[model samples]
Target: MIHVLFVCTGNTCRSPMAAALFNHWAEVMGMSSRVRAGSAGMAALGGEAASEHAVKAMARRGINLAHHRARPVEEAIPKADLVLCMGHGQAQLLRERYPRFAERIHPLMPYAWGLRTDVEDPYGGDLETYEAVAEKLEETVQSVLQKLENSRET
Candidate 1:
């Protein structure tokens, strides 16, 4: 199975949402058994739950966030076959901090769809911001799924 790790500044928001959304998508596409997905933060404040706005925003898309807990990137990095960051800066930081795994790290947008835009952090922002971030994440996740499929076929 391919292990995919999604990361951000804090696991309380973007990364968790990315994990949940991708997991849900994987299940729907019947690819969950072939791929293992999770999320973590570069400097995680562990044990924190996802923000209320983030929960609600994902709920609107039928993705649950109840099982998420903030975790450190180190916890997931070593095991990941692919480490996807929400932004280029995060990818740079991961590569600089963990040079051994640099080749496995990538910005989620460009890695998935060749789009270089970062997924904006919505922490402490309004629900609208959270929704916008989720929408971008969903689009990127779809692209990621397609990429994974093509790779598997090869």
Candidate 2:
């Protein structure tokens, strides 16, 4: 199994969004049995649930974030084949903190869609902002699935 870990400032938002979206992508591509995903935070309030807006946003896509609980970044790397971070800063931090895993750490958006940008945090944002973030995540996830699927065909 290839395990992917999504990282963000707090596990309440972006990372969980990426994890949930990745799982959906895995299902759509029939790779659910091989590719698995989870999320963690750089500075986390462990055990806290995902943000309300995040939960609702995922609900719109028929994904569930309700069971998500915050975890710290330190506990993530060892189990992950790839560690995707929400922002460049977070990716940098992971590389600095876990230098041995540097090659496996990358910014989620750029790694997913060749877009060198962060998945902006929407923790305190309104529902519309969460909706927009969800859309962006879905697009990125779809792009990643296409890339991986195409690669497998070759």
Cα RMSD (angstroms) for every candidate in the order listed: 0.9, 1.2
Specify the highest-TM-score model's number. 1
User: Which digits, one per residue and each the tens of the lDDT, describe model 2 over residues 47-95?
Assistant: 9999999999999999988999999988887999889898999999889
Q: Per-residue alpha-carbon lDDT of model 1 for 37-151, expressed as tens digits?
A: 8999998988889989889999999988976789999889999999999999999999999999999999998898788798899989999999999998988887898799888
TM-score of 1: 0.96
lDDT for predicted candidate 1 compared with the true structure: 0.91
Q: Please give the distance, in angstroms, between residue 20's alpha carbon in candidate 1 and its true position after superposition.
A: 0.4
Q: Give residue 75's error in model 2 in angstroms.
A: 0.9
lDDT of 2 at 118: 93
TM-score of 2: 0.95
